[model samples]
Target chain A: MLPHLQLGAEIEVGPGDDAAVVRLPSPRLVVTTDTLVEGHDFLGHATTARWIGRKAAVQNLADVAAMGAAPLALVVAISAPADTPAAVFEELTIGLTARAEADGASIVGGDLGRAGQLTITVTAMGSLPLDQEPVRRSGALPGDVVAIGAPRLGRSAAGLALVLGERALVRAGEDGRPTIMLRSIQDSSAADLLRWHDAPDPDLSLGWTVGRSARAMMDLSDGLVRDGRRLAAASHVTLDLDRAALAPDVEQLTGLAAELGADPWSWVLHGGEEHAMLACFAPGAVPDGFRPVGQVLAPTAHGPEVLLDGAPIEGAGFDHFG
Target chain B: MLPHLQLGAEIEVGPGDDAAVVRLPSPRLVVTTDTLVEGHDFLGHATTARWIGRKAAVQNLADVAAMGAAPLALVVAISAPADTPAAVFEELTIGLTARAEADGASIVGGDLGRAGQLTITVTAMGSLPLDQEPVRRSGALPGDVVAIGAPRLGRSAAGLALVLGERALVRAGEDGRPTIMLRSIQDSSAADLLRWHDAPDPDLSLGWTVGRSARAMMDLSDGLVRDGRRLAAASHVTLDLDRAALAPDVEQLTGLAAELGADPWSWVLHGGEEHAMLACFAPGAVPDGFRPVGQVLAPTAHGPEVLLDGAPIEGAGFDHFG
Candidate 1:
């Protein structure tokens, strides 16, 4: 099925308005910003200025939406090298417009200046809609269901792999030669994954909806299990993840795994940029478009474990600190 | 005693809100953005990050504000090298907050990325409170009083003189002395004018108010006489600046001229960053706080001419192109 969740309702003023108007009744607004400079974040890979612009807006908007707040407005500042064409700049403007529209946010006004490299910065805003208190990471209870929005390892890491791997190697892997398997992976799929790596969608409303219902909510930006363990440690709650839900994402990898002689489940259970909403919901209740991948259980001998049926699974998804 | 103009009452939401809400009875919001990169624009010669942050917002906000719209919200994206401390970053945040508060604008949210140098980018939003119509440069009428809200030329450029005097010899005279003295050229009576360049205020509402009764209006940002010529050319009216009111600004400059053996009026007339509001008002009535610095008349011998008393002024103010 297509994305069950549609974006753009909560925005008081959508894209093209001078500025957006959104309400967060609790009297506090959380704000943050980020920028991407060309040749710095990504070099010669499957990338375009448009995707770069889209990613710039999506990543920050995701942060606000992940907080269970309704995203209201976005402002951007772009600095391009003088020789860069007006068209590339124009495309970026349109790219930002698309991402903002996807989540019902608008690009109000920003500044442009000459610089050494292509740089884009975005500021996103969201409103805390409910009278109920915001769901924070510290409140995960002992019997909470640790659920996720979408399957982990969808594109970010997969795309990274394609970018780093040799084209001949990918072809051999998909062709199913056991020792020469890395060669068989399809180059086109790799290309698509690379696009995802550069520009991925962050489910804007999933976290907000989960925050309204769940006891504790946090964004699973760092891989599934790595972030899961961090959440458990932060909340002092024990976490045990179910392995079956991840099977669909990794099933195609089984043959590829045999060629690489590794387990397919490792990528699925641990990969990052899932943009998945993770939360500790009360028993027997799950928010829309969210799948229960784990549970927040009592503190135990296992100690914040990720389990496949009955055994612990190891993972370290895109570590930022290390 | 207090701010001559009481604002923020029309500001539905202020700096701390999720996104500042503004009444935009107009259909479209005109928008633009710019990003300032260290080592490129301000080579350690301008104000600190706090003041840079303020100027960054003001420059863009002034654009729409000049167009006669209400300030709505701002999205700011800042990138600093990894070596930057928590204090500098926090100070920049505070500076942005203060400027937005002063303008009755609010910060929404944005991204923080790693870069080799400091990059500050901002996008601001404005809406025409007067439904459907935004005041543009094309609307000046003949015989309108060319009024202005005091000349600027205070600190932003003055600080530049102080900061970069070693490398950049100020605009000089035959004696080879720096001819343009800032202190002699602005209203020293107003500390607000002194604080202005670093934190210039946009006359957004006044633009709307002026535009309603105004034949045409524009923010005197680039410079006074330079922008005056534009209004004259656009409305097909010649502007004649009264040299008397200007004497208060630079009568002392004439002594500076005697010391340096230069024409002091040239610096006061041409020095830039005077964010005072200048507009063509109806011939008979003038707005409060606005002075009749010039009057609109039929084209003279020089096309769209700006005259100092009976003589044509020698030069236009700063031009980004020039």
Candidate 2:
């Protein structure tokens, strides 16, 4: 029933068996899992099945990238209402396969079942390069520099604000692309921000480059401040950011923030779902395609903290339970 | 928060990072995933969170076993309501870890999220032993012996029927075990059947033995009749069973069936979730723990069929959509 589903050479035995067998590039296997639930990870009105599938695939792929591993394969388990349209399943499969193939990975196997709401759980496998070690979140040194793969942050959060705060400004187009009425906002960047939220494009290749040189690394999904705190906690260090370094990103969101009467700096620091790679590298060891955003410091009695311009930042980005 | 969770030697990097790293025993990695949803997979009143968690792990582990591989690790993704008690999560984690550890596998990593209903998705990884090849579902040939790992079947189905058919006869006890009211049937075997349905115990070691000898093998999840057809279709052969060969299994369930006014043979042939290993072996090559039940035959123009005493069996076991 699944057409255009291609299995890479690594797959020794594809689906239609008890399990799928794949040849690993190395003995070390890097694995991660993520779950996306309807009404929580996504909303029916704001996204399509294709986008949901893409988001599900990207989220786990980003985890593999964070470890500096080459993507290998993914096993997805989906549960939706029994009466869901077959077209939805087809689009979701296409989205999942397309996203995985883009990263040189394959959807080797999956399970489908009935549920009251849509849920997608993806488990992604990757392998470490022969010459490189995995960049863990615990290897950061006190003098390491904090860097980010992407130039901007908070675009997804801004896009979400546009949808939630000013619902009238966003409308689902026939092509599934959200069309902004833009009657109240004249900024062209708003459209890009909206698209970012709809579909995040994380720089996965850059993850490999950072993995080779970074002391500690992680993907920025829960905003810079929250995930930075996590990296700091894991490494037993504090991350101190230069406020001026983030000014450009904040400035980029200023126009849209004004349109919605929101703080641009808050979005830059606390907005999430960007899926950018964040790492701590030795002084002057930051790789190409990355920009320094902060520095790691020795631990203090206050435990792990993210400092903005010498002052500690308050509040976290997102907590599934909180 | 995860106490008593121990990482095996195979785990290079365990949870609390972006991903877990495990050392593979071989270049070939076997992977599978399964999802269990609330209401659809289990009922709140009839089962506990721990059973749900265990079932999720066992189903995926059985997939790994069916491939004749030693389970390496498991990655779990859970989505549940925000108001769920902390104890529920603890018990669920214990269930998952216990099941994985029983197979010498670790719960290497997991993700938790918020959803309206409970959902557990598990992805299990295993390694093909160097001395053996993967037993595919397409290698059965005419005259090969059809053998089953377990002598008994339909116990799980009988248990489910007891719960769903006569709910008033069971009540939740303080110890989490169901207390049978015993008004319908006082047979001790009926209680065993109920327990089997609640938590199936599939012998995984037998999978390794079968993998080394069987030409084609699959776990019987959807009952003998339906899955036999699948194995036959995959191998381009037909499976002709001797009714006398299945008489033992039918007799095992006869007492319970009579008490419930159900057909024993129907449950033995058509009940789902038995999770016993089914394989086609070279003539007279069945393993010690397995017993012969049928023989492979050349496919006719009508395609794959499961026959009993030379008569075609009618009806499928279970179809999620159907």
Candidate 3:
């Protein structure tokens, strides 16, 4: 038995923790897995192995931390076609090692094989040493404060648009001059949007600081409103957003509105993969490292709703298949 | 820490008992990953969810197992196109669970993505626990006794053929069908061939048994003879064989030989994925759970060194992408 097994309740031995350890009530081991497909999740040609590995490791690790679980070990499996150069595999190991080490977790085991295209799968396991039940999205009460994490939004999608010029905005802008918005995160800066687009450095610190004290919490991988609605539905409450407080990501969306000619608030409301944490807290429950965003109210006729300054926010966030 | 990090004379923080804290002496983790490429590794349409997962798990598990170290844990990344249904993923979980349950190791993490096909990537971690020195094929002694584990060969290939009507041999055999083979195992009367092929029950059994005692050991995933020559080349020795021990699965080959006059030893010496242990034991040494067969000797001037009953045994094993 591993010496950590002696750590006991923090880590339970349930048939060897193969796929997952089914947990009930207290001390639930946090787990979440995600798979990135070649054409759907990434570009088949442009994505590098190291970035894929890093992005793969970080996202799952973030999920566990988002639940306020102390990071433990990681399991990864990657699939790529046989013709892929061996160097890609080497790069992947480096990416996995770098991120895992930073998170104080190690890549324990993994699987690799030939595939129609590259696919990376990551599962993260975390130990929650809490006596109270984990703060799921279902815990928010009728009256609560809603908060959001510092989000670097639209960076990735913008970078993707630059790479895939097939976007209508890019094509429309191509006729004359460059769009100021695109030029900001352009290739010249050390803060190139492409790098973040390729590998989004998750703000795990925010999860660590605020997770446990919150009444209900969720990682915002999807756009704000979509994920906000999910939390509201989970807790059977209404979350009302202050469009006035919607920050710069929203203001900048005006440039995007000129291109797509849609409401900047729509993109602010619906752009996906922000990976921010949206949580609900009881009155006076404040945690460090969190930014207050909205409020939760009694259930409404709209049914477990989310509002943008007393009105419904339309448009859902991005979806892989949808 | 994994609770097992050994850095030469120094010990890094343990990686935790559930995982081996390995610092590969080679710098490189001698990795070779395989994806049970949906249609290629298994039936594109077969429902071996548990078996498919077992198949995918064992195939890669065997790869690391062949390296002669205890397989620590596996990272399982899977790709199934959308509309592939959740049940396939569920069954895969069963297979992964079955294999990972042992060794007190957990599946740390994984990736899932939409794909044009069903694909599985399993990357395995192995510890060259023998200091930085791993037991490789290149270290066999000339006077070593060549031996393998208990298995009736060609059962896995036969099972595949039975299920898919691909291999010529299965169509003619009554007892070798999947229905029969599965029934045998269910009845606790598993045919040695099926047992060796399907689940492969390969573990640290041989790694622990032969780590210190044997001169060389390898899992016989690729037919014994082909891999035997590899051991010979690595050890710079000559390998001689006896025809008698190769008679089990080749019994039917005799009648076919009498009809077409081809030797039965051809199949026994060259079929792959048997997963039996093939180790070279020093003279007068008997590694537990192994039987002695051919003996390793000083290199011979004869162009072909492998001989059966003093006559050359003619064949090689299966090749992947060969």
Candidate 4:
């Protein structure tokens, strides 16, 4: 199990005993924990263990990245049934180690337990450079320009929609579990969208690069409108999204939207799990990896809000309880 | 939810945005993660959320303590059904904050998700003093003496056995879930044992005290023989247990073991979930909180082993998969 997990040079005592000891270069540490549960966050019966593990690690790494820090290590806790094959856990470890290694990090320690449904919880630890303050969400100014690391959105939500729609055509496997069968989707791009939903490849370095000049930073996990509203509220400002500026993203999903009888605008505004970096920069300070998608304005008497094309947008994104 | 979670002064940015930014007084960080799953790690229907939360936090804190580090912060991830009452989560958070605060630590951040079973995954971060190295399990010398932080053992395992034996007499609640009913036990001490099983009270400061003079240290989560073998294997030494030294522990459980028709000696040797510190110190360097129970010896041709009175002993402890 220790061999399955990756250890970095910074690790003083790798996993074997009670805990892992690591030397962090800086005094400031960024910590975040996230979980992916079977049947809610993902279809455990349909999704591969590797992708599930990768998604769990990437989501937490995205949080550390959003803090504008370099990922140092990850500690994972996984729960599965006793009957689960050993291969599944090994594949999961491979996925977690590979994703952590992608950002020059390591899976230093973890705990494995028994549960009814397979569940994974990953906590990522990151290091901030000496004397550098984390780019917090509360630093956006009235005139700050709102930006996104990439101009792509809604692929994950669309992929989820496709899966749900095809559930009726699912084939039962030998284990009596429903196996994935996308009978209605024929395009490779659509399949790619499904893959994106299963395993999102977030740009881990973009936040650190943009943090150098950005006033505020965050990860777009719950959708632009939802997470953007949080940034605006934290900074005491209103974000006015430029619909025209997001035309490219909507266009990218228009074909799939039409086929699925869904609105591309809705997907662009409220889709979740993109894991892209959402940030606010000073006027003319947008970084290379990001594109301006909106502007930060003074909060109105009504309070901080998220506006689309000068009008208030009303829609909810992914809510765990909902 | 943020109000429910405690934030210490060491936190620069608390839970709200992406992650929590915390400051450590030292460069060395000890990290560990552990999980508790319903119907597997615990009987959720019979346990209170607060006690469950306390047990979850204590187990991880014990790991950090075993490394001879000061508990700094905890990040928790919880998953439960969407229909769960908010009060349950609030209580859980309260228990977590209370336990961490007892050691001058805080619950800096956490995640909540939906799952079929209630599960909690806690990651604790601890800071080592400047210029001090963590007490690892592989540092034991042949002449070192093996000790237990406290003479208490098998209380948790005995408590669990009591609960399992009474499962057949469980009463159904309004929610149709089985509720706890311990009709067979009438003694108050027996009830206290059950409480101990639910919420372990690990001496958080004892490890640091003993670690100052310890050569090897680990948490006694599994039974003595199982975990002792681990320490011996890691240190490349054999541990010769003095059964006479453990007579007091067995005596403490003799009454309860008789009621359960079990051997008190077996409980002392092979019970799990103690959360007590196990360490090795120089022949005359046993700390006030620890009691010598064995002596380390050179590894023989058969390699490192755990022995009872110089004779090889064999037993098994808790295994998540098993």
- The lDDT leader among the candidates is 4
For model 1, what is the alpha-carbon lDDT of residue A313?
Answer: 67
* DockQ of every predicted complex: 0.19, 0.80, 0.13, 0.79
Candidate ranking under lDDT, highest first, comes to 4, 2, 1, 3
Report lDDT per candidate: 0.58, 0.82, 0.57, 0.82
lDDT of 2 at A207: 82
Ranking by TM-score: 2, 4, 1, 3
The residue-by-residue lDDT of candidate 3 on A1-322, one tens digit each, is: 0111112232221211112111222223444566777787876444466767778777777676666654565666676777877666766666776776677665544555566777777666554544644556778887788887664455555445444543312211222221323433323421344456566776666665667788887776666777888888878999988766676666654554455435555556776655666778777785766666788998798799889788876676666632
Cα lDDT, model 4, residue B272: 84
Segments in model 4 whose C-alpha atoms lie over 4 Å from true places: A167-181, A320-322, B167-181, B186-188, B320-322
lDDT of 2 at A234: 92
Ten residues in sequence with the least summed lDDT for candidate 4 chain B: B167-176
- Cα miss at A279, model 4 (Å)? 0.5
Q: Can you write out model 2's per-residue Cα lDDT over B208-316, one digit (the tens) per residue? A: 7655588998998888999999899999999998799889888888877787888888888888777778999999788888989999999867888888877888766
lDDT of 4 by residue, A1-322 (tens): 3347657788998888799888998878889999998788887545677777788888999899998998889999988887988777877777788888998889989888888888999999987876788988999999889999875888888777776666213333444233456666555577667778777887879977656578999998989999998999999999999999999888888888777888878878888888989999999988888989999999977899899877989888765423
Candidate 4 docks at the CAPRI level of: medium
Instruction: Point out where model 2 deviates above 4 Å.
Output: A1-3, A166-185, A320-322, B1-4, B168-183, B320-322
Error of 2 at A309 (Å): 0.9
Model 1 interface CAPRI class:
incorrect
> What TM-scores result for chain A when each predicted structure is judged separately against the true chain A?
0.77, 0.93, 0.79, 0.93
